[model samples]
Target chain A: MVIDLDRCTGCEACVVACHSENNIGMSTPEEAARGRVNHWIRIDRYYEGQFPDIKVKYRPVLCQHCDEAPCEPVCPVNATYHNPEGLNVQVYNRCVGTFYCANNCPYTVRSFNWFDPKWPEPMQLQHNPDVSIRPGGVMEKCTFCIQRIKRVEDQADAAGRPVADGEVQPACVQSCPAEAMIFGDLNDPDSKVSRLAGDGRATKLMEELGTKPKVVYLEKAR
Target chain B: MKHLFLLLLSVALVVPCLRADQPILFPHSTHINKVHLKCIDCHISADTRDAATIPGVRKCMLCHAKIAADKPEIKKLAAIAASGREIPWQRVYGFEKAAAVKFRHGPHARHKVACATCHGDMPNAITAQPLVKHNMGTCISCHRQNNASDDCATCHY
Candidate 1:
């Protein structure tokens, strides 16, 4: 996935879309106030310069699907593992809720379900059938929409062809109103994600940490 | 001492056989053998969908309405259908909700696994029974045997 920081307006359509598509529960008033709101994808806002010359930057952060994910090794139950497709996938059932994954994560992308997800009447109807509604006390992070990936792979396999570039799009990528996000097969040189990764402006979060997150961020082009 | 041991052994054998019978008398002996109805005839979505769904009352009525319509069980089914209700069929085989395992019958059926593979031999079953304990190890071993992916994400989302 490639995110162009220059294009983001901080409108947060991607955040709303992620919650809706993934069946993430709305935080209660109490939980929200406690800074315990559950969000798989979030914008990290930072203000640059002093009051007279200040600019706000919004960088969307989620599970990097890191090549050397700190969360994966810390998991005692092996609930979260790096898939062959390079996704850092989490199995909610296997997760024992140690929260060790969340703790070890440099990006702090993993979130724990505090209670059984509650949807107000009609809200339940909006939940996606493909993504399993996570149970309480399970640590869940962004899967980069593994269900969508699998569906595309299944279709490609049935047709005896390789998955096409831009075939799989995570909910957040498709929902970005600014068209700031891009998702594709990073392995393919001609793919948009691969191209963006090689851009001069492209960099990753906390590069010194060497987590090697698949998500590449393009800094604001001033 | 010998008499007590013999009686205890007989009771243990009898108890399991009695308990193994399902609540409903959906005998394969009658449905598959004498009647010769296929599994998919009742399990409508077995070949197509994620779930091998059970037949609704109407499916049962297709044959039961004319054949042995006077039987008490058939009458009950007819009444339920007339009242616009689905049969409260308890799950005979399933993973627990917390296990979060997604088992699609369509893929397994496409792989040419007979219903008896994981479910055990049901050709002579008197009623539905959860004969096989579907755990991760069991699934992984079978996938290994078939050279299928044993990826954690394959079954668990």
Candidate 2:
């Protein structure tokens, strides 16, 4: 995934899209006040300067899906691990409510299910059937929309062809009105994501941590 | 010894009563053997979709409108078709939501796997019943033999 900071308007379409696509539980007003809102992708706001000369910057953050993931090793149950496709997968059934992985993660993206997810009346009907409604006591975060990836892969496999570039778009990438995010095979040299990763302004979120995150962020133009 | 015999007797008596009675006793043997209707003729989506859906009363009425119009079951089916209500057929095989198994019939059907492999000989049975037990082990074994993906995400999302 390549994110162009210059294009982001901080409208948060990606946040809403991620919630609906992943069947993320809604947080009530009381829960929200307590910082219990479950947002798989959230826009982090940074204010530079103060009083009349203020400038605001927005960075959309989610699971970085690190190559040397700190979360993977800390998971005692092996509930979280890197898959063959390079996705950091969380198996809800295998999870035993251990918060070790959440603690180790530098991005702080993993959220614990404090209560059983409930949807009032008609809201339950809106859930995406592809994503599981994670039960309480499990830790979940961004999967890069593995369900969507699987669907496209399955179709390609059935047709006896490789998944074309730009064929697999995560919910966040698809819903971004500004087209701020690009998702594709980073290994493919000609892929948009791969080309963007080689851009002069592209930088990793926290290069000092040595996490080797797959998401590349382009610097906001000065 | 007497108590053990009584317990065994009770289990034997109760086991056969477990199968729920359908709204209509659909005669699978008669339809397949005598009429020579293929399974996909009624389960239209089996070869191209996730669900091998149960045919609605309208599909049943297509032939029953003339062939067995006088039969009691046919009359009941026709009445359902006229009322424009579904038959409320009970599912004979399905995984629980908690299992998160997304079983698609299309790929399996296209692979040339016989319907009888998972469903058993449904055409020879008098009525629809769960003739085969489907568990993760059964699916894994089959996949292993066929050199198909046994990845956990393949079925469970």
TM per prediction: 0.86, 0.90
Worst window of 10 by summed lDDT in candidate 1 chain A: A151-160
The 0-to-1 C-alpha lDDT of every candidate, in the order given, reads 0.83, 0.86
Question: Residue B39 error for model 2, in Å?
Answer: 2.6
Q: In TM-score terms, which candidate is top?
A: 2
Clashing pairs in 1: none
Candidate 1 local lDDT, A1-222, one digit each (tens): 999999998988989988888888878888878877889999999999999899899999988888999999999999888988788999898888999999999998888888888876799888886778888999888888887787787667656789999888889989888999999988889998998899999989897898888989998557
Residue-level lDDT of model 1, residues B89-123, one tens digit each, is 66777767777777777778867888888877566
Candidate 2 chain B: worst-modelled 10 consecutive residues by lDDT: B13-22
lDDT of each residue in B1-157, candidate 2, tens digit only? 9999999999985553344466676888899999999999999989777778899888888888898799887787888889999997777898776666778887898788899999987787755678899998999999999998876666766
Which candidate has the top score in lDDT? 2
lDDT string, candidate 2, A1-222, tens digits: 999988898999999999889999988899889977787889999899997999888899999989999999989998888888888888887889889998899998998888988766688899997788888888889989988898787688779899999999999999999999999998899999999999998999887899999999998557
Stretches off by above 4 angstroms in model 2 are B1-20
Compute DockQ for each candidate against the true complex.
0.51, 0.39
Candidate 1 stretches with Cα past 4 Å from truth are A47-56, A121-129, B1-24
Assess chain B of each prediction and give its TM-score.
0.83, 0.86
